[model samples]
Target: MGIHIIKMPDLGEGIAEVEVVEWRVKPGDTVKEDQVLADVMTDKATVEIPSPVNGTVIALGGEIGESLAVGAELIRLEVAGSGNQNGKTATPATATATAGTTLPGSPVSTVCERAEELEEAPAPVAKAAPAQAPLLKAAPPRARGLAAPAVRQRALELGIALEFLEGSGPEGRITHADLDAQLLRRVKVAPSGPKPSDPTDAERTIAVTGMRRKIAQKMQEAKRRIPHFTYVEEVDVTELEALRAHLNGQHGNQRGRITLLPLLMRAIVLSLKQFPQANARFNDESGIVTQYDAVHIGVATQTAAGLMVPVVRNAHKHDLWSSALEVARLAEAARAGKAVRDELSGSTITITSLGALGGIVTTPVINHPEVAIIGVNKMVERPMIRDGAIVARKMMNLSSSFDHRVIDGMVAAQFVQTIRAYLETPATLFID
Candidate 1:
């Protein structure tokens, strides 16, 4: 009977605008108070906007992948009594709905109910709906399915047709639980007979939005502004690996198990003492390079969503185990989408590694306005002549990149060599 307008809430940290990544509710969808209406992406993270009062969605503020300024209208809704829009009352005849059009006392809810009914029965081979069909509709017997963005992504990856599966969530919305159930049912019913390969060309066009878009823009800016020069050095890490294994064996239960990353972090922390310029940020606008004595190392981690860099604050303060624990915790938080804004930013330098997948060398891009990034390559056993005799040693390559504007080539090489020296001689890491 009344109109309510919800504007985008300020996501703090002076973010002026945000990209609309997903819409949980569309026009005509009834939303409850505290129900998430949309998910918007800030530079650092994705934030959900919730409804303050129960209402029916009247108009969406923007399309998916569109950017909206702060204080811009996010959604308009039809509510009971007087609303925020000058106490205006929305007429039933003028109410606009799209796609999943639902009129008052319509059979939309019944369609969802029928889908739930089918789910309770034995597994039925349902026909897949056309890809362009609206996911939620009021059609008879075969109304389409509803799911969250994450669930839909996972379903897409697994080649599961959402229309064929029933959702157990509110209003029959599909969830990760439903996905797991579907997988279980699939495994149980799989036939032992040799199945013929049925492969068809299916194209999917995914709009670049959310975290992916942010990553793209950041990477583009960094590449455009910085003149990067990479330096690669091979280090024998046999002693370091041995020391890590011994420490893990001794303190596996008491303290957390030690990984190569903590040892490398310790080496980096120590190396920063000698070359402080590497631990610095550059402001291209002012042409000023600010150096920091305190080292905040950014560890580049790959999550299901995309690449994320979670900073390990004050790396100079933490011991090897403490650093390892912090790195693990931060990486886990980043992967689980629980990392706050502070945890995702303010790094003096960055470290990137692909673990076993790291090949011979890599030219890692600098995390701009930072000057340098250290890349870690895979370790492999190779024949070497150390004291004029053939022997096997675990060798790994340290491929690092630096901004040529501030850091000289010699200084970059010296920084990486310092880290290699500390790693090659594991005892020195504990000395200071």
Candidate 2:
């Protein structure tokens, strides 16, 4: 028998630490090789960490929501074999100063070296077995369902049909709110419980941790470092609307249809040809600015987790339909919490919209390091003065922000004017 200490694996480049979101296996649980032990969330994505070897878990490294540094001790395990319990052939490993002794198992030795430098520790001796605690049985047969144990128990006590109730949680997992809603719909009352005597107007506090903390830090950093200059312009998108309707009608039968965002994105790319500063990144610390040849458009999307900006690579390379499809794919992936690291960064410019909920013009913040961000406002039909008369025209405002250090007022206005021209004319967008 041998004891092995598992260290947190390197997640990715530039990732120093990760937060433990959930632990799948408990101490004393027998886990198999490659079985998921926990889900750790980094700034980029939530990744599942799998067990490196088949072993009984002795201890977890940290509690939930605790941050663990890369290469830190993650978990301790007791295994039945000498070579990581896999019985795989071991390879010779060079002894390091951190370890006075080296094991034939290269993988285990490498892991231990990274975990910590123990001072002349000898091999672990097998200990006598201890009395096992009483295992808790699962809920009654009638309480069995796809919901969590607590939700299942509540539903069973309330005589709710799990099969009939629709889940509102991620991946169709039933949430307590879903059960409550179901109960309310049927009986117009919450689950039978004692009523509170009175409600007090007390302060409620929410911990500023997790994604919210990250967002606050990033936003503060951006605002503190970048000198923001906002520009607002109203465009007559009447013709653009017509063109969009025509394109959607033609492509409506397909799996992905055209939307105003794709059209606007293409127009933005074309407009960048006139003013490339807006489609560039500025490093204030190094006093360097980089302008990219290809336009990687970042679509600012709001998800249940928080605001996520998923980039659509090579926006200039794709046609209108292709860009629309890619945008749809990236947006869906971002909202579903499946966006990859590449898709979440490296955007030359960003576009934000509230869809139909877009109110009047907004002063958008420049995405940090990126020189500019384009904000799309809701389209509404309003009275506008035409050549000879006041007419009803579909109009929308483009609220854009720029890093004043890189983009000037005249240059920013001209860039937006170019976008407006393409949107108003609709035919200019096809001009190579």
Candidate 3:
């Protein structure tokens, strides 16, 4: 048997390095061609590295969360016959299988290529620990219960043994409900009698890695570089809400339901026409601000992994229904970790909202390179004096932050006021 090496492919767009997020195989594990070997995180998205040839994994080039430079050795494998390694390395032409998005220049092909094109010489291979013998065979034990793949994965994550629990599913299959019941039983049988006044302090040290690490770094850099100024304004959205409800009632069956986000998006798009400065990207290092006529709105979405801002390209071209549909699709993709690199980048401005959790006021941080970010707060009805009557009005606060160096206080206020007027009227949003 001879050795074969896979190097990190050049995932274009000037990506110099990537972080190792996960490994699918270990030493001695047999992997097939096109099988994913590891997951690496770029600045935009996570990409998968797949095996080009069937082989046994022999060594991993980096540890979890380790940053690897482009063209560096990623993994080594042992194969039958005369393998590619002979004081030199055999590099796969296409080393990446992007998880959900394709890299700009890296195409998925089956052709094998030599490593001579990559100028960097191969790094010394670190010795790998001997693979441990399997404690159990491939088949499950007789006492082990039948469970779906998802259930089995969840059980592994919870550190619960399948053989210890009785199943509640059809044909004695273990379901998630069974695992929940087991957990409830354990909680009920715990020691209840209080013996001491003090309780044990427990803590978990979680490594900031993967998406979370990238988010932390980006936020830190934005806050450090940009001098941010916040502007808060209350908007009367009673008419806007009524209009949205009316439209949803009229077209709920014919078309998809509409949410307040689409209306707000419309207002933002229209408002940007008067204030182009708000819809621009600032390069502080170059001291240049580039304005765009096309409105690309980045909708900040919270996912299980972390905060991800998926962009809605050319928002000005879509109406309420189309905007709502696009927003829903992008949000779903982001939450499911399926959004592509193009959907995740190139936003001229950003919009963030917490829905019901949005407080009365928030000092939102400006998305880096973008001059402004508009934050939406929860809507509430309060008693107000309109003309001579004390009536109820739905009020919502818009908390927006702008780069003080680029946009002055008066301009930012005017920009927010423009959005407020469009939202309050609910008809001017369609005029232009």
Instruction: Score every model by TM-score.
Output: 0.74, 0.72, 0.74
Per-prediction tally of clashes? 0, 0, 0
Candidate 3: clashing residue pairs, number: 0
- RMSD to the hidden true structure, all candidates: 14.8, 16.7, 17.6
For model 1 the TM-score comes to 0.74
lDDT of 2 by residue, 1-432 (tens): 776778889988888677677799887699999999998877746678898789887677766655666886677777876634343432111112124556655767777775665445666788866689577798664322467664676577679888876664433556555654665466544457775566773334444445564566568668878999889999999998899888778777884678899889989999998788888999887999999889999999888878888898999999888888888888899788788777888899999999788898898877788999999999999999999899999999999999989999999999999999999999988987
Q: Looking at candidate 2, what is the lDDT of residue 320? A: 86
Which stretches of candidate 1 lie above 4 Å from their native place?
87-204
lDDT of 3: 0.84
lDDT of 1 by residue, 1-432 (tens): 778999988988678777788899988899999999998878757788999999998888766766676887789988998878753333332344344565554456568778899889899778988889976766666345787665686688789999988765445667555665677677667568876575563333445567886787688779889999999999999999999999899997899897888889889989999999999999999999999999999999999889999999999999988998999999999899878878999999999999999999999999999999999999999999988999999999999999999999999999999999999999999877
Off by over 4 Å in 2: 83-198
Best by lDDT: 1
lDDT of 3 by residue, 336-356 (tens): 877877889999999999999
Span of 10 residues, lowest total lDDT, candidate 1: 88-97
Checking candidate 1 for backbone clashes, the offending pairs are none
The TM-score obtained by model 3 is 0.74
Candidate 2 clash pair list: none
